[model samples]
Each structure stands twice: as structure tokens, then as C-alpha cells.
Target: MPCRKERDERRSYGGGNQAQQYYQQSQGAGGQKPPPQAPPPQNGAGMEGKFDDVKPKFNDVIFALLFLAQLGAFIAISVISLRALPASEGSVGLGQSGGTATTLNASTAWLLAIISGTALVLSILLLVLVRLFTKIILELCLLLAVAMSIGYAVYMWVERYWSGAIIFTIFAVISILAYPGMRRRIPFSKALLLFVIRVAKFHPSVYVIALIGTTLTAAYSAYWAISVVAIYQKWSPNAEGASTSGGTPSSGAVIGLMVFAVFNLYYTTQFLTNLFLTTEAGIFGAFYYGGRDAKKVAWGAFKRASTYSFGSIAFGSLLVALLDLLRAFFQILQSYESGQGDIIGAAVACVAQCCVGCIAWAVEYLNRYAYIEISLYGKAYIPAAKDTWNLLRDRGITALINDCLVGNIWTFGSYAVGGLSSLFAFVTVKASNPSYIQGNSGLVACITFYAFAIGFFICHSLGYAGLSSGVSTVFVALAHDPEVLAERDPQLFETIRRTYPHVLNPV
Candidate 1:
């Protein structure tokens, strides 16, 4: 491991500074080519030997059991919530007592039922339909659009979606298949997933780190929940007869605004906390797996994430929080009836959602690249973000990330896991506690489901962040330091060079 002084020296010559100087000298003012020289060793010549001495130090079998226990703890609350929901055949009207589940609308429900009934057969039909198309404009474009419309219609029926609100997420899976850049990412996505699982499987401590972040975020959330109640009480001191609006906005409206502010603060805090936590995981994975100062990776990640790069963490997190806040307000609008202003509300909804998408894309793009650079290179947030963008743009990796959809894949995949786990939770309660799920179970189920979902989401977010960040880090590291890439894993280096020649090889 590099000593403190040596580490400082490494930072002085690392990341954007080195990248700029190297690119300038090698590529000239035109900057038309990658540097011919292999990147110097990350922490000087003797560091690799020190890294070698730092063995993995994890007992696979023992750590596997420990990891299981850690993950089980995270899911236990979710399961208990599911088991407590009103799932009985006629538990005081399933619709009314089932809590706030995202059930299908009447038309959507019927459509989903029909499609779900033929799920096994639909695969074959869809595959045949896809194979039948031979023309680019006809098959991939026209025919695919028709097929996607059908699928989207089904989703809209059940999910209550607005058109064009989220082009990235709504048609994300299909987009990956249809778009050429994303289509190329099919293989890299698998490779990235495998690499992430290997990291989790071997270095079980990663789970502990994830759990810690999730726990702290939950704690702060609980504290905020309590604070919200106090805020509401102050707004309506005379709770029983406070419905009157005293020549101003109703107390509920004020409370809602306050709650939105609290939510923004909460989300900002959550991401910053998570950025540090998952950045720790990214750092550990990068060094331990990348064959660098493995033993000191944890400490190094902390000094870099918590100290030097805190500003980046805050700024990126704020963008994420802004999106969350906007989405929450949008949901509020959707809930309230729009009456004569329906057209105005619809227009506002479209604009609000567009803003949400822009912020979401920015945060996603920044964090995916910037966090990796921050961990590996120890650059400040803005500098890291800017330089990273230039690197990806110059290498055409920017287009790849957009079309490839790996980031969205991981995100939606995590949500799927959370949904399934929540479903299991609902089922468990319905099966085991038939009597409790009867009359007056609405509030109980609602509270239980809310807690369950919150816990499930936090746990899932923490667990998934490392994997997502790891994938980006691996690719960025591969591009930034080919020498380390080739030395650490020649097989992976060859795979990158072969699979993404546009990204790995200089023009």
C-alpha cells in the first residue's frame, strides 16, 4: 500500500491533470489520437508488489454464509410486511383493504390478465414475428413499433403511464434491442453483470458496506418522518376543526409543500450517503480486483469520497433529489382532480415530466462516469465530470452508454427485484394471517406495505449501486489505464479490445 505521502503524490499526478497533459503531448491541439504510451503504474513501480502481498483475505464459504445473513436481514422486514397485507379472498373487499398497492385499472387489469395467461406462448409468437421481419425500415422500425405499441398499451393499461414521459425507461428494453449502439451492448452487459456478481461472491464485505448505508439512510428517514408529524401538528394545532382555509392556502397544502421540501432534503441526504458508501464498494472492487493497493483501498476510498470529492457527491445528489422532488409533486398533481383546468394540468404534467427526465439523465450520466473517475483518479467533482465526458465523447462511449442502456437495465432490474420481493411479502401475509387481514386491516396493511416498500427500496438501492458503479468503473478504468487493464486480467483486456474496439482502441 502507498503511504500517506506517496498517496498524496499519486493524487497530484492522477486523473484529469494527467489525462490533459498526456492527451496534449500525444494527440496535439487537434487531439486526434490516444496516447501511445501505456499508462504509468497507478501508484508507481513497487506498488503492484505491495498489492500482491495484500491477498483477497476473504474465506469464500464463511463469507458466503455471512453475506446470506446480511441480505436476509435486509429482506426480513419486507417479507413480514407482505405477510401482513390484506390478501385474503374477501378480506373486507380486496380493492379497499389491500392498502395502496399499484393495482391495474379496470381495462389494464383485463389486458394484463389476458397477456399473462398467454405469457409462455407469447414468447414464441413474438420471436417468430421478430424473425419474420427482414427489412430494416419495415421489421426493426415499423414492425417493431407496432409490436412495441401493443406491449406499451398493455403496460399503460396496468401501470397508468403518460405518453413520451420517459422514453428512456418506458421503452428501455425494446430500445436496447432496436437501437444499434445499445444492441452492441448486449454482450458487454452480460460481462458486466458477471463481473459484479463475482465481486460480490468473493468479497462478501461489500454486502456489509451496502447494509450500513441502507441502515443509516433508513434511520434518517425515520427521524424525518417523526419531524413531519410535528410540522403537521404545528400547522393544524386544532386538529379536529382545522379544515377552514383562513384567506390563504389550506393547512394540507402547506403541509404538502413542507413535506416536499423534507423529501428533497431526505433524498439529497440519501444519495450523498449512498455515494460515499457505494463509492467505497467501487474503490474496494477497483483496487482489490484491479491489482492495486488492495489492502488500503477502503481507507483510500474514504479519504477520496468523504473528503476531496464531497462536493461532487453533493452536486450530483442534488440533481437526483431535484428529480425526486419534481416526480413527487407530479404525483401530487395526478392525484388531485383537474376539472376545467384539465388541459392546463395536462400541459403542465408534460412539462414537469420533461424536466424530470432531463435532470434524471444528467444525474445518471454524471454519477456513472464521475464517481468512477473520482474513485480511481481522486479528481474533484466538476473536473472529473467534465474530463470524463470528454473522454467518453472522444471515444464514442457516450453514444454507447445512451444506446446500450446498461445503466437503465441495472436500475429496472433492481426495481423488478424489489417488486417481486414485495409481492412475496404481500403473499406471505395473505397466506399466514388470514384473520388479521380481515376488517379494519386497511390502515395496518397500508402502514405495513409502506414500511416494507421503503425498506426494500433502500436495501435494493444500496446493493445495486455497487454493481452499477462497478460496471462503469471497469470500462472507464479499461480506457484510462490500459496497462493496468492488461496486467490485471489479460482475458478481460482482450474482451474489451475485441468487443468495444471503438472505445478501447484509439482512432
Candidate 2:
């Protein structure tokens, strides 16, 4: 927490003196400031046409190298696993097809690709729709979330889960009560969302980047899935005589390989997702800070994200990936314990998993804001994260409203996209009735579930990477320099002021 004076200084946002004070305060102990950067736009200035050269220095290069090394190791393992697959190209129980057990094969991989591709298209389409009907989607998602919360609370209470029931009931009640106050912020949220959309319309590369990310994610998902299957086939203890060396892979070795492989998958996927988001944030941050050249800024940001700031993005991704790995581990432990009927052990694992999951969520949430700073200033991850923490504290109300209202829009929008994609996959698979899964309702359902999971994550990465980056950039920019918005676009400033009158000051 800040001292009272610091807090007061942060809260008082209007006027040149206050702004200067806040800026100076941000410089901290040594009074050092960020490098000279883009100038604010003039009133009514458009964000189109040529862009200028703006280069940034490399930050957190070590982490970028580490990520590359990790990728190399994973690739080596994948290659080995692929080679081993031919020896044990057999299948265990998956599902029955034509009265025989279905097996993993090239056809299975192709089907997975098709399903994931369907999700890719559906995710992109739904993202567009969400941009168009932001308010409606937001409202509907909120209603659904609230209803689910209440229903879950009731179920938990009936099941005699006192802690879960109490927690969820509180969440439900608070949501219901907060809705009235939150409702007023909807217009402001909509306006901000539209502003980002308008900027994206000017820069089509925004969507292009998202497309690249979604494609890479989908492709990687297929590759990882196949690699996992190959590992299991080659290394399973049951594959005694099938191994190329005529020796079975020990159970411990199999587990180790799988664990590392899964960790690499999580880490690589996370790095790609954050890379997309940081790049998007760089573009938006450049625009927000009044870079005259939209094209140059967009490309420049992209270059920096993939080069100079790559390590910082990797560093952030590593943290989240590690947490995710831990959470997964705990979940597995919980499942094992529950299956063993060790109630106390299962509860402990459950709590640990929940704690780790929450921490992971918080880290990722912080990274969203931190990436704005990183994208704009090229600061290393630690400093960027610290700056974001202060920004949240100083602008708590705006952050809250943005998270509660605007954030939920992208989140629930992704869910909607995933659901649609899952339906599309189910219908397509049923209609085609492919040989690998013919007459296998269980197999079809399994495919549908994978589709939903992949669709949800890919949509989240793609959708959130672009629009949500815009939102966070806007928030950070406004907090850093509202005067720019006020001077450059007085009309927008006043419109925001109407709903968030204290935006000029502090809410």
C-alpha cells in the first residue's frame, strides 16, 4: 500500500500539476524516467497511413534463450518419440468402431486437425460477432455466470459441502447486489470497446496477427496430441516386445517423459499466447501514445515483441506455465487420492490445486497489465510487473470496472465461441461418420470434448490477445496520461467523463 500522501497524489488525476506530480512519482527513488517515446496525437488526428521507425532494446534476453533451449529439447524428444512410434503402432482401448477397438492412426490425426480447424474458423467468426454485439453478449454471459453460480451454490449446500456452498453463495449475492452499480459502467465499457475495434479496423494486421496465433495454436495442438500418443505407444510398459531395442521402457521413464513433454507443451503454448498478446499490446500502446505512423508502429511493435522484448514475454509465460504445471500435478494427485478413497489426502490435494490455480490466474492477470508497460517502454518483466501493481493500486476503481465488465465480455465471448465450435465438430463428425470413429458415440463425444477444450483455449488466446490488449493499453495509457486523450480527443474525453466523471480525477 502507498502512503496517504502517495495515495492522494495518485487519486488526484486532473490538472497539469497533478499529472506532473503523478508522472514524477512514477519515476520513483532515482527520479529516472522511461525513455523519450511517442508524442500524443493532435485533436481529431487519424491513425492511418505511414508509420515511422521506432526501435526498442532487448529486455530479458536470458529468458528468451532459455525458452529457445527448452523448445529445442522438446523438439528432440518429439522426434525420438515419433521414430519410436513405428515399433509400437498399436492401440489400446479408445472406443469401439464397427465392433472393434478404435486405434490411433494418421486418420485420427487428420480428424483432430479438421475438428481444430473448425474451431479456428468458429472462434474468428464469434470474435467478430462479439465485437459487434458487445453489450448483449456481456449481459448474457453475466446472467449465465450468475445463474450458474447460484445453482452451484445450491448444489454444494445440498451435497453438504459447507465451505464451497458458503463461498459460492457469497459470490452469487455479491454479484446480484453489485449489478446495479456495475450497470452504469456498461456504456463506458462499450465505448472503450468500440474505440479499440475502430483502431483495429484501421490496422487489419491486428486480426492478421490473431489469425497467425490461432493457426499456430491449432497446429501445435495437433502436433502435441500426436506426440503424446507416440510417447505412450513407444514407452508404455505393456509395449515390452514392440520396442526398437527389444526392451520395454520402464514405468518411471514413461512417466518422466510424459511429464516433461506435457510441461513443454504448456510452456510453449503459453509463450505463443503471451507473445501474441504482447505484440498486440505494443501496437495499441504505440497508437495510444500517439505514434503518427500506424503501420510502422504496428510492425515495429511486432518486431520488438518477437525480438527485443521476446525474453520478457517468455519470462512471464514461464511463470504462468510453471504454475499451470503445478496445478496439473496437484489435480492428478487429487484424482489419485480420491480414487484410493483417501478423503483427507484428496481434500488436501484439492485445496493445493485450487491455491495453485488461483495463483496462476493472478499471475496471468497481472501479466496482462504488465505487458502493456512492457510493450510501451520495453522494460524487463520484473519492473513492468511492479509498475502494473502500482497502476492497479492507483487506479483501482477503473481497473475493477474494466475487469468486471470489459474483461468478462472477452471471457464469455470465448466460451460462446467454444460451445459453437463444439457443436459444429459434433455435427460434422456425426454426418461424416468417419471410419476411425464410425458408430462410436463415445468416440464422437470424446472428439467433441477435445474440440471444446481446444476451441475454448485457442479462442481465448486469439480473442483476448487482440481486443483485450486494446482495453488494457487504453487503461494504462489513461492512467499514465489522461491529458493526451483530453487534448487529442476532447469529445471522447468528455464522453468518458460523463459516465466516469472522476476519470479526470480519480473514481
- Global CA lDDT of candidate 2, please? 0.68
lDDT for each residue of candidate 1 in 209-293, tens digit (9 for 90 to 100):
5545555555545434433333332234333212333323356754664665455444545455546544554554344233322
lDDT of 2 by residue, 174-228 (tens): 7688667767667666667777777787677788888798789888987887777
- Which 10-residue window of candidate 1 scores lowest in summed lDDT? 50-59
Alpha-carbon TM-score of each model against the true structure: 0.56, 0.76
State the lDDT at 93 in candidate 1.
Answer: 25
Clashes of each: 7, 1
C-alpha lDDT score of every prediction, in listed order: 0.45, 0.68
Candidate 2 regions off by >4 Å? Answer: 1-55, 84-108, 131-184, 239-242, 245-248, 291-293, 397-404, 422-449, 495-507
Model 1: number of backbone collisions: 7
Q: For candidate 1, what is the TM-score?
A: 0.56
